[model samples]
Target: MENNQPIISVDHVSMRFNLSKEKHESLKEYFLALAKGRLQFDEFYALRDVSLKVMPGDFYGLIGLNGSGKSTLLKVISGVYKPSSGTCRVGGTIAPLIELGAGFDMDLTARENIYLNGTVLGFTPKYIDSKFEEIVEFSELRDFLDVPLKNYSSGMVARIAFAIATITKPDILIADEILSVGDFLFQQKCEARMQRLMSGGTTVLLVSHSIEQIERMCNKVAWIEKGRVKMDGPAAEVCAAYKQTTK
Candidate 1:
């Protein structure tokens, strides 16, 4: 049974990072400045007063220009960063494909990385064993399963990561620019897999620069600019407005 409540809630969230102004030629200078308390810095807010609510089973898209906080918001929801203010609440299990090879060991074989990443996502060894073949099949990397991940191309790594993440239905799937990495055919395959997951009641939060992709796959869209949400509404309407701004 699908619940009427929101599965993900982000309320007035803000994230700030401190960046140093001085550039050091060497590590010694960097450490010396740090010890002398002479490291001048500035604060940059990646997200400011951003609030959002995603209903259960909703396919939500976040659209923004580069450096416009789209990925930051996903990171916040994924618990990769502590908000500078406000709160974010999530219901049920989450499978996050925030960055390619984020949870993977580059030195390990593709097959080994799958098991390692599965464990990180809270699956037992036996559960991973059961899904091993399915993941490999979907990844289409059966030939490279025993090869070290560092040897694979970016697209190949993305394939393995996507296959591992979506091996089972999760309550929420957070994707940040994942579709942009793979080839066109593989991208279509991933989209089909996501559609199946949505039908099975998985809520998805997607971040993409491709407005067309967002408009096609998402039911709702949020447009973020300069660390704040400029628009939030139906996918088509919001995407139309965002496109106008870019032109």
Candidate 2:
């Protein structure tokens, strides 16, 4: 499928952030300074001329050290952020588990949030309704369905998030270390679900610190370094090269 049309085309994309040079203690102070022209910003490029192609059914892995802009690139591909330059074109439906509680209402009950989050992930109300019981069963939150999300543990939130995101077979699944918060058993469940997704021809864009997982799951790997793609190639080749950096 490498020779086929790309499922995801990221062409020379760049994401820029303007860092406020001055820190204000409160929103009032920040807004006051902004209105008076007393604030300054420094330009930062989270992604600089980064380009890559993810073909249909490709299980792509992104690896990097902390603060290397891996998440930013995911956000760009997820359409949470518009690139400052260039473009990212994604084909088909996307289920993004990039940020837990992203589309969730903390004050809402887990039962309510399932419909809420599912809609945000692009599921139609009727579709979500049909899959409601299945999602709840997978999440193992049938008992906690009425609990407010804010009161749930991180692991609990992760369970619901993963279950909802994977409720339907999305064309692409974007995950960012969400499994790391889950217990070992739950992580295994998430991995199993991902494996099923792969079997169904779903393209997956995953960011994880676990090189072994990447090596096991990804046919292709992209090593991001300081907002740029340092290496992009076969999983074995790029993982071996990336491993040398840790040594």
Candidate 3:
């Protein structure tokens, strides 16, 4: 697939965060606390020297343990966060399903949120209008579409958000642990829809801890550890390597 031409290119990307301790001294007590040494802020690197290329129609899996910067990398790719150093270029329109209901307004009705979410995913109102029925059916939220999102359960919100985010087929689809939501049946449905998208030539970048899901869905894999790529190769091979290291 390396010869297929890259749809996404991440070059030596690094993300850093500054952590500072808050002061808790009153004005009257400031003089007594002023003798404290200068506050030292620790710099945390979420992702360091990360680089990869994703080709069109490739189902790329990013696997890592908690705090391995998998989510940070996804955010950088989705433009939610900028890298401290390095370059990232995406060739086509991107739809990011990083967090369920992340961008939804709890006070808005599900119907309204559909348009809002769809717009954020770069879908025109007309496009959302055309796919409205399909999205509702997929989410099984037709009866609750007019109700405020706050009244819906978390799973319901996830379903609705997933449906809305996927209504418009994007050139690049980025998913971060979205499979952990909903019931077993809904998970099956979501997986089927994802298969359809991949078969239709959409590039997919999936971040998940589920090795089974990665093995079943992805052709290539990148194992990330401590904010760096530990290994990148065929899905089965990389997954095997990850399992060995973790165990």
Question: Which regions of candidate 3 deviate over 4 angstroms?
Answer: 1-3, 23-39
Candidate 2 residue spans exceeding 4 A from truth: 1-3, 23-40
Candidate 2 per-residue C-alpha lDDT over 122-197 given as tens digits, one digit per residue, 9 for 90 to 100: 7899999999999989888888889999999999999999999998999999999998899999999899999999
Clashing residue pairs in candidate 3, if any? none
lDDT of each: 0.92, 0.93, 0.88
lDDT of 1: 0.92
Better of 1 and 3 by lDDT: 1
Q: Find the 10 residues in a row with the least total lDDT in model 1.
A: 16-25
lDDT of 3: 0.88
Candidate 1, residues 117-236, lDDT tens digits: the string is 998888888999999999999989999999999999999999989998999899999998898999999999999999999999999999988888999999999999999999999999
**Model 3: how large is the Cα RMSD against the reference?**
2.9
Alpha-carbon runs more than 4 Å astray in model 1: 23-40
